[model samples]
Structures are given as C-alpha cells and as structure tokens.
Target chain A: MNAIIEVQDVSKSYGGVVANKRVSMTVQAGGITGLIGPNGSGKTTLFNSIVGYHPIDSGSIKFEGREISKMPVQSIARLGLIRTFQQTRIYAAMDCTQNMLISLPHRKMKFLDAFSKHGESDHAKAERLLEFVGLYEKRFLNAGSLSFGQQKLLEFAMALMNEPTGLLLDEPTAGINPTLINGLIDRLKRANREFGITLFIIEHNMRVIMNMADKIYCLAHGEMLAQGTPQEIQNDQRVVDAYLGTH
Target chain B: MNTKNIIFYVALLVLTAIAPFLFPDFRTQLATLWLMIVVAMTWDMTGGQMGYNSLGNILFYGTGMYVAAVISIGMVHDVGAYTDAGRLELMTFTERQYFVGAIVGIIGAGLFCSVTAIVVGYVTFGLRGPYFAIGTLGVAIAAGELVSNWGWIGGGQGISLPVYPGNFDVGKLFFYYLFAGTGVVLFMFLKWLYSTRFGAAINAIRDDEEKAEAMGIHTMRYKLTTWAMAAFFVGIVGGISGFQLIHFEPLETAYQTTNLGIFMVVCVLLGGKGTLWGPVIGAILFHFIKEVTWNYFLGWQWVALGALIVVTVVYFQDGVMGWLAHRKPQSPRL
Candidate 1:
C-alpha cells in the first residue's frame, strides 16, 4: 500500500526545550500504524505537526503526497486528516447526537446553511456511530456528564462521523476500563476494516499496539529509535531497553 | 408546539401588541426596555454562545445610529448642510419623507453595521479572552472619540433626525412597535439558529476553540458570521433609537459606553450567559430594577446598579437559568 502520511526530518521545539527533533515516519494507506513513546518523547508533538496543530521548526509533512505543514488545522481537517486529543476534546455542553452532527465535514456549507435543518440521514449516521461506540443509550445525555472512558469513546465516535481518510488517535484507550478496552479495540479494528479508514494511533499500551498495528515506530528523547512489524518491535533490544526497560 | 408553549407565546404576543395601549404613559419606557432586550440578546450571541465576550458591541450601535441618520438626511438634504448646526429651522420634512427615510434608514443601518462587524471582527477575532474584550472596547471608545472630532457628521454635537410625521402619541406607539418587532424577530431567529448545525458549531467553538478547529470547524468564519448577524439587529435598533430620541450626541447618547454598552453585558450576566430566555428575562428584571432605582434612589442610582452588578457577579455568576439547571439537571441539551 502507498504511504498515506509521510513525515520527513520534522523538528519542533517550545522555547528552549525540544519536543521533536528531525522525526521521520510513514503511515501506509489502509493500515493501522502505531506510534509508541515514553512520556514527553514528542509523540504528540509529531502528531500535532502532521495535523497542522502548530507551526513546526523544520521539515515537510505530507498527507496523500500533498504538503500540509503550512495549512491551518481546519484546512488540514477538511483535507480528510483528523486527530483526536490525548485528553479527548469534545463539545461538553452539547449532547452526543449534537456533537456527532457538528462533526460532519462542512465543505460546502454557507453561512445561511447554519439556519437550515439537519438532514435525517445525518441524525441516523450519528446514532449509528454512537451505537457503534456503545454510547447509543447515552446519546441524549450531555457529553460533560459522561465518565472519562465514555468521553473518550464519544470522541472516537465523533471522529468517525467526519468520514476522514486517515484518523490520528492520541492515546485512545488510556483512560478506558480494561474490560471496555477490548471492545474499543474491536470497534477500532472494525472501523478500519469496514470503513476503510487508516489509523495512526499514539498509544502507550504495548499489548494493544503490538496486537493491533501492522507496523510500529518507537521514539525516545525526541528522536525515532525503531520502525518494524509488531513482532520485530517486541524483540528489538533498543525498544526493550528504552521503553520496556530491564525491569 | 405543545399547548402550554403555544399559550405562553400567544399570551406574550398579545401582551406585546397591547403593551403600548395598556400602559400609554409607559410607551417610551417600554420601547427602551425592548431596546435593552435587543442589545442584551445580541451581546449573548458572542459572549455566551461563541465564547467571545466583546465589550464594544456598542460600536455597531453608535455606527448604526450615524449611518441611519446620514442615509435618511442624505436622501433629502445635502448631509453636510443638514447636519450643520447653524442651518435654519426652515428645512422641513414632508410626511412622506419622514416615513420613507425611517424605513430605508433603519434597514440601511442594519446592513451597514453587518459590513462593519465583518471588517472589525477580521482583526479583533485574532485576540482571545481579555485581550479580545479590551481590543473591541478600545475600538468602540476610539470610534466615539473619532466621531466626536469629525465635523462632517455633526462632530461632538451629533445629528438630529426628523420627528415622526404623525401625532405624538401615535409616534410613541410606532417606535414601540418597531422595537418590539425587532426584538421578537431576533428572538425567533435565535431560537431557530440555536437548533441548527451552525449553532452547534458555535457552541463547539465556545467549549474549545483549538479542538473546534481540529474538528474541521472554520472557527474564524463562524465567529465573524455570528458577530455580523448580531451587529445587524443591533444596528437596526440603534437606528430606531436615533429616530425616537430625535437628537443624540456621539459619546453620551449614541456610544454611551458606560451606560447601554456595559448594561448589555450586565443584563446577559444577570440572565444567564448562554440560554435563550436568560437575556430576555435578565433584561426585563434589570430594567425594572433600574427604573425603580433611578426614580427612588435618584442620586444613588449608579451606585445601586453597580451593587446589583457586583451582587450578580459575586453571588449568581451562572444567572437564573444556570442556577435552575444546576438545581435540577436537565436531560441532553443541544
């Protein structure tokens, strides 16, 4: 498969501290790509740069061969590259259905279109996605009232509603219950398989990433340390030493 | 609509229709109340819904007054000569001229203010939080000062519009209906708007700007659009106010930064920051208190208002609707 997202020698820093330094990676089309790193290893910074969340210090990031490092976050999103936050950002004041409806890509929506009624299909799809994420029963509830794990699930469902070409998930299962984690993993896989969505996930959960990702990239100290299949990554002495540690 | 809702709305409409006749002596006061409600609701559009608390919305109000006045006068007399304080009282407006000018001028003011909002918002929307508030307030303040010095538009003296062509009582009723009509339409518009995807987009922006952008919302566009819409209604009301007042100075009556400007913000805060009924309820409650204090307290009216604002902020920061929501958490809200 062709590379859907390509990052070349990208580096970013905040004031004196370096977040990412000359990071380079590729995510294949129609594949689950994993980004594994320790805390403050610049995994999120790399995702932010790739998705145009901030201006990078240096390097070219491409989505489907088109340079997007200079584009605004919304413009990048409109190009079908969407990202969820590490802490799960959602319209907490709105209900799950309203949140889902707002997630629809408004490519051709005019100012007056805001006054127009939402289509019935949009509601149906929103409900379908909410159901897919196991939040259908809670669809009528405000997102702020949801538990952390459930909020994360709602965020994931919101991302799916956008119908993006590639989804960059930042720690999707971090706050989730272990029992719900497996179900979320199953839903994520089904989304990839059925919806044909390419996922680039930043996860600290080794077992989940290793079991799910076709290929994994490891980072340490703001630089890439390893890139290989899940099997190869598990045995890599560098990843073992830096991430897993001898203990 | 439910029977209860229909009854409530019908009663409201009937009350509004007969309010001028019911309290003929309070026609001017009722008109001013509608003015307060309009400004407060418009202020909530950005302050409550979109998370941009602009303290300078009065900029549009003042500009609307000027634009409408100019348009009406310019259509008949040379605007410069008409605004010239030295001009003779011999310049008289026919009944036709008065009615035509009022209608066209009010509409022109609304459109003109919308354009100004888009232009001003392009620059101001870049600033976040307090900086945005200060930036917009500075704009309104600066406009007042600038207009005060500009001789072309009557400068510090300000312009005067022709009085309504009919009897004094009839005119009061006309202005009252004008304000009431605008307020009602704005209310209906917001009701519909808040139920749309556009409304959700703005609420998303209010919840979190960066996340909204990443979610594919063109936040700047939405912000500008919402402000312009708000400005449109504000401008229309300002035009009506100009015709009603007959004479207005730049700073005190038109801009009135410390008066109507701040009152709108206080009204929204008193009502609830982001609810449909909050601004309306808040404006009504605030208006009554203000009228009472101004009448009885006299010299200490400002102090009373200040105390009310302080109490509202300190004690009921969430306003009435928020307190109600907290007391009895409602099911999913859009």
Candidate 2:
C-alpha cells in the first residue's frame, strides 16, 4: 500500500520543554492508524506539526510524496488532507446542512447568488453526507442544539464534505456516550473501506484504539514508547508501564 | 428567498421611494436619515457581525467624504468657464462635473478604504479582543492627524464644493434618492454576506480562533474580507454625505472625538449586534430618541442616553433583538 502521509524525525519544543522529540510515523493509505498516548504524551503536538498547524524545529512531513512541512493549514487542507478538532468546531447559528455545505470544496455561488432564486446541486451532496452520518433528521436543526455525540457525527460529516483523501481526527470519540462510539467507529471504518480514505486517530480510549486500530503507536513524555499491532501493544510491558506509571 | 421577506423588502422600498413625492420637503431630511442608517449598518458588519468591535469606521467615512469633495470640486472647476458668444451652453461644467465627480469619489473611497483596511488588518488582526479594538482606534486617530496636517485640501478648516448652477432643491432631491438607493443595496448585500460560507467561517473564527484554524478555516482571510467589505460601504456613504453637504472638514469628517462612533456602536448594541436588521432598527430608534428627547432633556440628554446604555448592558446583554428572540419561543412553549 502507498504511504499517504510520512513524518520523519519531527521535533517541536517550547521554551525549555520539548513537546515532540524526534517522533516518526507513517500512515498508510486505506488503513486506520492510531496514535495512542497518555496525557501530555505529545500526541496533539505531533498532530499539529504533521498538519502544519505548528512549525517543526526539524524533520519533514510529506503528503502523497509532496513535502508539506511548511505549508499553511488551509493549503494543506486544499491538498486533500483535513483535520477535525477534539472539541466540536461548527457554525452554531447555522443549520446542520448549512454547516456541512460551508465545508464543500467549490461553492460556485457569488455574493449576489444568495439573494437570487437559485439552488446549488451541492445541496443533494450535503444532504447525503448528513444522512450518511445519521444526521439527516436534524438537517434543519441548528448545529449547536445537537448533543455532543451528534455534534461529533456532524463534524465527521463536515470533514468529508471536501472529499478529503486523508482525515486526522483528534479524539473523535472523546466525551461521547459509550453506545454511540461503536456507531461512530463503524461509520469511520466504512468510510475507510468504501471510500478508500486513510484515517489517523489520536485516542486515549483503550477500547476504541484496540478495536479499531490496525496498528498503534504509543507515546509517553514526548517520545514514542512502542509501535505494534493492537494485541502486541496490549501485551507490551513498556506500554503498560507508561500508561500505569508516571507518564 | 422567503416570499414574505421578499415582499416585505419590496414594499419597504416602494414606500420609501414614494415618500418624497408624498411629503415634498421631507425628501432631503429622510435621505440624511437613510445615510445614517447605511453608515451604522456598515459599521455593524465588522463590529457586530464578525465581533471585531472596531471604532475606526469613522476613518473610512471621513476619507470617503474628502475624496468625493476633491473630485467634484476639481472636475467642476475644470469645465465651469466658457463666456464666448454663439454657443448654446449645453450644461454648466459644474453640473456635469459634480455628477461625474460623485461617481469617481464613490469608487475612490471604496478603493481607498479597502486598501487601508487591508493594511490595518495586517497590523491589528494579530491582537485579540480589547487590544484589537484599541489598535483600530489608534490607527483612526493617527490617520485623522495625518489628514489634518496635510494642507492640500483646505487643511483642518475644510473644502467646500462650489454651488452647482442648477436649482439647489433639485440637486438635493437627486442626492437623497442616490444615497437612499445605496443604503438599501448595502443593507441587502451585508445580509446576504452574513449568510454565506465565508460568513460562516467568520462566525466560527469569532467563536474560537484556534478551533477554527484546526478545522482548516483560514481566519486571517476571513478577517481581511470582512474589513474590506465594511470599509467599502463606510467610504461610499461618507463620500456621498460629504458631497451632499459640500464640505470635508477633517475633524468633523474623521469624528475628532468618539461621539458619533459611540452613537453608532450604541445603536448596534441596543438593537442587537449580529442580526441583519439590528443596526437599521437601532439607527432609526437612536435618531428618534435624539430628535424627541434632546429638546426637553437639553444638557441631560446625554446622561439619559448613558442610563439607557447601562440598562441595556445589564439586562439585555445580547441587545433588544436577542431579548425578543428569547421571548418569542417562550410564548409558544408557555
């Protein structure tokens, strides 16, 4: 399989503290990769660096063989790599469909088009995405009025609106109800399998990481502790010690 | 478009257009009122809708007025003299020049404001909250001082357009219709803008800048766009007002103190900040209050206004429109 995203010896530091220390990883196309870490384990820093949210002190990030280590977040996004916030980011005043539509790639309408009597074909696509995320019923409802889990679902739908090739989800299931996590995971898996989109997930939930991740990279204290299959990661002493001991 | 809303706007426009014919002398007065509404609404675009809280809207307005005045005066002077015999003086150069000058001035104001906004955005958008607001105010003050010291256009005293060789009432009537039309167009444009994808991104950035960046929304671009749009309309309105009044005094145009700026901000805040209709409603209400209560209250009018502001801030944090929105739903539930 082609490597969709490759991060090589990426490092970032703030003042005296190192947020990411020479971390390296590769996300293969058409697979679900998980970055598992305890609190303050540099997962978010690594995510930021790879996604070009923060400038890395060293190392390079390549997306589809192009060096994008210095590209701006919007440019990186335009190149078919998209990220979602751990906390929901949505237009609260807008309806759910409107939220999804805002993220659509090519909005052909001009300033006056909104007032004129015209409709975009993207409306159908927006509705379909909403339906796919199980948010079709609430399409007309204000996005802010939805529950936390539903908001997560809406965010997922929004990320896919640009028809991204790769998605980086920051704690996709965090604060979500236990029952809904399975549905969220299943939908993500289907998106991967059916749409051929790669996903890199940063998750603290062991159940989610273990069940969904093909491979997991464990980080502790700004360094990677281990990289292995889910079963192997579960049995690894270093992983256990990092999670249970001082991290 | 919702049919009811469309019908409502059309009816309002028709009524406004016909009001002059009905009332005759009231045209110029209503036109000035319309111009104030336009300026206030444009200010709301940046301060209220996008939550930038700018106090520099007067900068654009002042510049616009000067630009229009200079162009009209220059053009009219160039063509106003022809004393030779046997020629039918088609239209006095002053009349033709003023007409052309108004168009040029409007365009110049928009361009100037947009460019200035870009520079200001670059400088101050990096600052957050009150710092940003203060930065914009400082920029406006500095700009005003620069214009005052420059002796090209009547220095600090001001420039006056030579009276057009036509009936003054006709000229006033023309200006009234022009500004009124512009006010309607700008309001509708702003309303449409706030409903767009770009506007959505702006609101998201306003709510949480970091999260918006994470979602791949370019916050800087949205900020610059909002600044430009706000500046464009402010400049145009300022230019037209200056042309109609035929004067461009720096201190008066730039609003030397915060009086007019504060009044416009108060209007937006009192009516409701982010709502499309908030600023217009606020402008009309504010003007009515000033006209009705100022004579009776005299020196205490400002004090009363202050008290009203305090009550609004305390009780109606989201402004009157927000309070109404909150009240409307509860009635059905009750």
Candidate 3:
C-alpha cells in the first residue's frame, strides 16, 4: 500500500515530557488506518500533530506528499486534511443544518458579499448529509438538544460536509451506546468503501478497531510498541502486554 | 429582500421620515436619538456578534470626534488658530468650506478609526474573555488621558466645530437628516450583514474560536474585519456628533467614558445583544430612559441608570432579542 500520509521520525514533547517519541508511521492512500494506545500514550497528540492543531517539537508530517507541520489549521483544513475532536466540537447553539453549512472548507468568505444568502446547493447538501447521519427529522432542532450520541453523528456529518481528502477521527465512538456504535461502525466502513476517502482513526475499544482497521499501530508509553494487521497486532505479545490485555 | 420585508422596511422608513415633521419641537432630541442608535448598533458588532465585549469602543468614538473636529478646523483656518480661539463664532466658514470640510472630516475620521481598530486588533484580539474586555477598557481610559495631555488638539481646553453658514434650522435639519439617514443605512447594512456567510462565520468565532479555526475560518481576519467595521461606523457617528455638539469639552462630551462609552455597551446589552434589532430597540429605549431620568431625577440620573442596568442584566441576561428569539422565529424586525 502506497503511503498517503508520511510521518517519518516525528517527535513531539510538552516541556521535558515527550508525548510522541521518534514515531514513524504511514497511512495507505485509500484505506482505514488505526492508531490505538493506552491512556496518555499520546494518540490524541499524534492526531493533533497530523492536523496542525499545534506545532510538533520535531520532525516532518506530510499530507499527500506535501509538508503540513507548519501550516495553520485553517489552511491545512482547506487542503482537505480535516479532523473531528474526541469530545465532539459541534456548534450546539446552531441548528444541525447551520452547523453543517459553516463546516464547509470552501465556503465563500468575501466581507462585502457575506450579505448574500448561502447557496441553495449548500442547504440541499446539508439536508442530504443530515439525512445520511439519521438526523433528517431533527435538522432544524438546536444541536445542543441532541443526545451525546446524536451529537457525535452530527460531528461526523459535519466532517463529511467538507469533502475531506483524508479524515482523522479521534475516538468517534468513545461515549456512544453499544447499538449506536454498531451503526457508526457500519457508516465508517461505508464511508471508506463507497466514498473512497482515506481514514486515520484513534480508538481505545479493541472490538471496534479490531473489526475495522486494515492495519493497526499500537503505541505504548509514547513509543511505538507494534504495527501489523489486526490479527497480527492482536497476537503481537508487546501490543497485548501494552494494551490489548486479555482481549 | 422579500415583498413582506420590503413593505415593512418602507413603512418604517416613512414613519422615520415623518418623525421630525411630526415632532418638530423634539428635533434635537430626535437627532440625539438617531446618534444613540448609531452608537449602540456599532457597539453590537464587537459586543454582540463577536462576543468580545469591549469597553474601549469609546476609544474610537472619542478619537473620531477629535479627528473630525481637527480636520474641520484645518479646513476653515489653520489648525493652531482654530483651536487657540476655542470659539465657534471666531471660526467663520463659507457654505462650500462648511460642507466640504464636514464631509471630508466624517469620512476621514472613519478611515482613521478603522485603521486604529486594525492596529489595536492585532494586539488585543489575541486576548480572550475578560482580559480582552479590560484591555480595551484600559486603552480607552489611557487614550482619554493621552488626548487631555496633548497640546495640539486644544489640550484639555477642547475644540469647537465649524459654524453652519446655512439657516440655523436647516443646519440642525441637515445634521438631523445626516444622523437619521446614517441610522437607517447602518440598521439595514447590519441587518443584511448578520444574515450572510460572513456573519455566520463571525458568530461561529464568538461561539467557539478554536472550533471556528479548525473549520478553516481564519478567526483573526474575521475578528479584525468586524472590529474595523464597528470602528468605522462609530467613527462616522462620533465625527458627526462632534459637529452636532458645536463645542465640546474633551473629557466630558467627546470622550466621556461613563456617559457615552459605557452607555453604548449597556444599550446593546439592554436591547438584546447578538440579534439584528436588539441594539436598535435597546438604543431607543435606553435614550428615552436616560432623558426621563435626567429631566426628572436630575442629579440622581446616573443612580437610576446604574440600577436600570442591573435590573436588565439580572432579569434579561440573554438580552431582549435572546428572550424574544426563544418565543418567536421571525427575522430582522419585530
């Protein structure tokens, strides 16, 4: 598999505490890639580094053959490298549609022309995507009113609205109910299969990542413990000892 | 605009047009009302839309006042002589000079204030929450002190504006129309602005800056742009109000923090911040209460104003617009 995202020897630290220690990984161009680690193992930090949420201490992060470590979050996002937060960072005050509309990476931004209405296509697309998230009936409801699980779905839908080249999802089902988790897993697979979009996911749940990832990278104590197919990673003694204990 | 909204706006315009003629005795008061509207509406851009509740908006208003005064003075006579006399009668002007000077002064002051906001924004927008609010407030107070000490623009003695060569009533009428027309134009523009993509983006910034940045909305550019727009309008209104005052003591009328600056912020809050009509409605109501308190309570008016602000804040925290937005789902107007 050709690497679409190359993180070669990247090391990030906070003060004297290293969060990512000379980490190296490659994501395939159009396949589901998983990063799983124990708590404080810097899974989220790695995701943040990739998406330009903050500057890394050292090393290079490239997206589709272009360096993106120094780029601003918005500019990085404009290039279709987008991410969703582990905690779900949606606009709760706005309706699902408005939240969807504002998430577009290519929305027109002319100061003078802001007075013009949003495009009908944007509204139609927002509706269609909300429907995709099983939120068609609640499109106009204030997103704050949505349940935690529904909010996650809304965030997923929001990310899709941007037509991202690669999507980095941080714990997409951390707090979701078991039934909804199954639905989300189905959608994630469909998103990868039908849309043909590259996905890099960080997750803690063994059952979920085991079922989904083409290849899994396990990080332990800010260091790469192992990398292989799900079955191999599951069998790999270091990864099992580090994280997948008894699972 | 839709036909219903069009008709509604036209009727509102006609009512405003007939306002002065209907209440000729209250023309000056009506003119002041319009100025208050401009002040509150401009303040809402930062305080309401962007959620950067700045106390230093008075900085732009006061600076615009002085900028317009100086430019108008320079137009009629040399700057030194105009400020040295500190008398409106001493500085005589032609009709051409008066109109030309006032127009240039208003527009020039607006440009200057916009630049000031952009410059100040780079430093101040980096700050968040109360740090930003207090930072702006400190700047405004410092600016007032700076202007008072500076000798060029009349120092603490203050300056007088150009005497209108036109009839006294026409002069009043002219400034009246100017402020009233400005009020109408500003209301419509803000109404349109808050409905657009730019408006949504700025509101998004107010809601969540980090999330907005993650969405690829450059929060800084939008914040600076909105602040500059707010400053430009305040600048124009400040410039025009200076000319209206004829003569103003620097600290009191032109840059009075308590009377004008804080009051503008309070007006936006009272009306219902973060909505299209909140500032407009808030300004009119605020102006009315202020006038009544000043007339009846006299020396205790400020006491009344403080109490009223408290009542508004404690009871109507979401603002009148926020309160009404919950009840009904109409756009723009009441």
Top candidate by TM-score? 1
Model 1, span B1-334: residue lDDT tens: 6898889999999999999989999999999999999999999999999999999999999999999999988889888888888987567799998889989999999999999999999999999999999999999999999999988899999997888887999999999999999999999999889888888888888998988889788899999999999999999999999999999999999998999999999999999999998899899999999999999999999999999999998999889878877887853221
lDDT of 3 by residue, A1-247 (tens): 6888999888899999899998999999889999998899988889899889789988899988999999988888877878899888888888899899888765335545555778898899999988887999999888999998899999999888888878999999988999888889989988888777799999988899999999999888788889999999988888777764542
lDDT of 3 by residue, B148-167 (tens): 87777888878777667768
Q: Mind giving the per-residue lDDT tens digits that candidate 1 earns over A149-220?
A: 999999999999999999999999998999999998999999999999999999999989987999999998
Docking class of 3: medium
**Worst lDDT window (10 residues) for model 3 chain B?**
B82-91
Whole-model Cα lDDT per candidate?
0.92, 0.78, 0.86
Candidate 1 stretches greater than 4 Å from native: A108-112, A244-247, B331-334
- TM-score of predicted chain A against the true chain A, for each candidate: 0.96, 0.93, 0.94
Model 1 lDDT, residue B52, Cα: 97
- Best candidate (score: lDDT): 1
Model 2: per-residue Cα lDDT over A25-73, one tens digit each: 8999889999997889899899888778878999989999999999978
- Considering only N, C-alpha and C atoms within 3 Å, which residue pairs clash in candidate 3? none
- Model 2 C-alpha lDDT per residue in residues B256-293, reported as the tens digit of each score: 43666667777888778877777888788877776666
The weakest ten consecutive residues by lDDT in model 1 chain B span B325-334
